[model samples]
Target: MSDVVYTTTHRVVVPFYVYAGLAFLVATGMLFTGAAEFSGHYFQPHILAITHTMALGWGTMIILGASHQLLPVLMEGELYSVKLAYLSYTFTGIGIALLVWAFYIFHMGWPAKCGALLINAGVIAFFVNVVMSIVKSKKENIQAIFMLTAAGWLAFTTLAGGLLICNFTENILPDGSLHYLSLHAHIGIVGWFLLLVMGVGSRLIPMFLISKYDSPKILWSIYGLINGGLITFIFIFLREAVSVLYMIPVLCVTGGIVLFGFFCRKAYRQRIRRQVDEEMKISLLAVVMMVLPLVFLIAVIVTLMTISADVHMVLAYGFTIFFGWLTAIILGMTFKTLPFIIWNRVYHARAGTGATPVPKELFSSRLFNIMAVCFIIGFISFVAGIVISNGIAMKVGALLLLLCAFLYNANVFKLLFHKDRML
Candidate 1:
């Protein structure tokens, strides 16, 4: 069906799309101006700011908005509370801004602590809404489970983050915030982002590919392995174990990812649709992009077995996950998803009546293609720069990424402001 089962009000969902677009532009700008920071420690001020901008502002914000609109559809029920969704947005938006600014200025005072607390509160609001929605739904699926679990993890991540912020000045944390940074990052990445993406992508990918293949058993297995891996990692982290101890969870998560890849392959092979769109192709490429980080991560673990880990490997691993795989998937899927959300607002009632624009036509494909090219070149160059500590390549890459971000924002805003027209 063209319409979502219970479509959220445009007022509720559109703001997120707009905010995410602006945040992406702002993040790229920071990336360009702060290109030098890429050579330094990941724990530095500007690096943290840019990371949060992409993570909370661009990534989490978009996911939150999409989830609010989609959960009801996936559950075949209504959202638990629109008010809660808006509350999550308000607190998250202001909190991200405060946090980003504080990080940029290297401020570890009230603004930082308050920002962290606000973000934690926002995650709580989201977690409550999601759990209640799942509980209320009569027919529950693995997707719902994945989402609810991810929400819980997000709450934990933010709570840890807040404590990390507090630890900066209070100095109450056991091993200093730096020691727990890996734990914080992994909790957010593996537990929250990866699981949530798998959940949403499993449903969306098959649907878009026109693959009739469905396997609850395989999905449940993926869920088990991924979460199992995450739990093991957290345990190892808390125990302060190093070397081969880390490998256990790493292998488990890797095994889970391998299963996921196999599942996607099966879906693709079983697909009834012969022709995939450009957007779908990019999304598929993103699925392939997942492999890069796995390789880098293995390298990082091996390096850790030695006296010191290679900083370049650590940075590239992170960059690959966030900017490479995650960004690719989001970039591809935004057009695929957002156009439909916007199209429903404009043409839901008139869909069967006359010549209404298809979701694909609401946004410019040319802009998307050009942006993809920029992303490809810039991503490779930026990674190569970081590996070799080449300032010139890094700056050039950032500049291209900034241009790509501009085109992306332009296309997104174009859809947001799309005028109602009858052809």
Candidate 2:
């Protein structure tokens, strides 16, 4: 592999990823605990706390850290300022802390409102810095291209989220607060998280797999379909005519998935490293999980044609996306990415010396596989629990998820502390 020319001296961004990973671990743990409470009947505060804790605290935090590290490489220029990066982290951290506290402990009120505002401010600041840097860059890269678009969506996500928060306190929406929650969540999930993942995966997966079959066209197709579908969906759904409008975006999104699946298949076939790690193997399951929600949504739309689904069905679908698919992908990818990050930053310089270890030699794949199995079982149980309102199943599922989080964090810390290994 050749040296990636765009890298700069700033390694501060690396810590952000680590911090975000730590946050993810904690938030995931909280999610399990909170889920247990949800099992013991259902509490709005517990659900809200767990959902935001994972979404904002875990997912957004990691994305923020990764984007900071990626921008310089993609833009072919240094970040506009490291101080701004630090400031963004600080503000977001404070906001998340307060917001979580208010949700779990104090309910949605002034504290939650204030936290939402601050979180939105931090998000806006991050977007401004990133967008401006991209515009000012000397060269345009695909990673940067996807990121800029994703950042725009992130801004929308946060803005909508802020409004939702305000609605909790002040009833800003006429139809009630959760009327637009699906729209808000999907935009963030598909637009910001999913798009960025596909974009970055298009680049990194090939590199990591050591494959030469580059399909930029497929990537563009995925981008176009997903974003186009989102735009069309928003336009139609926002019109208050929910009947036919929902179908438009649903079809569009399915088309996007087809494009991505084709590309993923191509990449897998072309990959030189035939026998990959357990992480790669398990991550495949995540890709497969993507279809579950779509199938559920189709059923939902059809059901609504007769009679709409209750909140439980909606919650079931949401859990599948949030934990089943997205969380699984993140967990599997973290194993790969975290090891590489650790190796690159801590052990790369010492390579070929007797002291340094290879990246592959990092952790016990057996251990990871055990956790993955536990997680899958837990996830399935939890989804079943939600659908059937089985408290016992839900509690078991939460415990399993909690165990996975603990194992993941322990593995990460093992890598960080014992720097001799490639992890």
Instruction: Give the number of the best model, judged by lDDT.
Output: 1
Question: Which tens-of-lDDT digit does each residue in 1-423 have in candidate 1?
Answer: 335366678788888888888888898899999999899878889888988998899889989988888888888888898999898999989899999999999999988988998888888988999989888988778998999999999999999999999999999887789899989999999988889988998999899899998889888988998999999999988888877788889888888788788888888999999898888888888888888988888888898888777888888888888778888888888999899988989898888876898889999999999999998899899999999999999899899889988999989988988988889
lDDT of 2 at 153: 92
Model 1 segments more than 4 A misplaced: 1-4
**Residue range with the least summed lDDT across 10 consecutive positions in model 1:** 1-10
Segments of candidate 2 deviating more than 4 angstroms? 1-4, 8-11, 14-43, 352-355, 420-423
Per-residue lDDT of 8-97 in model 2, one digit per residue for the tens?
A: 232555555566566666666776666655544333776777777777877787778767776877777778877777777878878887
TM-score for each model: 0.97, 0.90
Worst lDDT 10-window in candidate 2: 1-10
Candidate 1: lDDT of 401? 89
- By TM-score, the best candidate is 1
lDDT of each: 0.88, 0.75
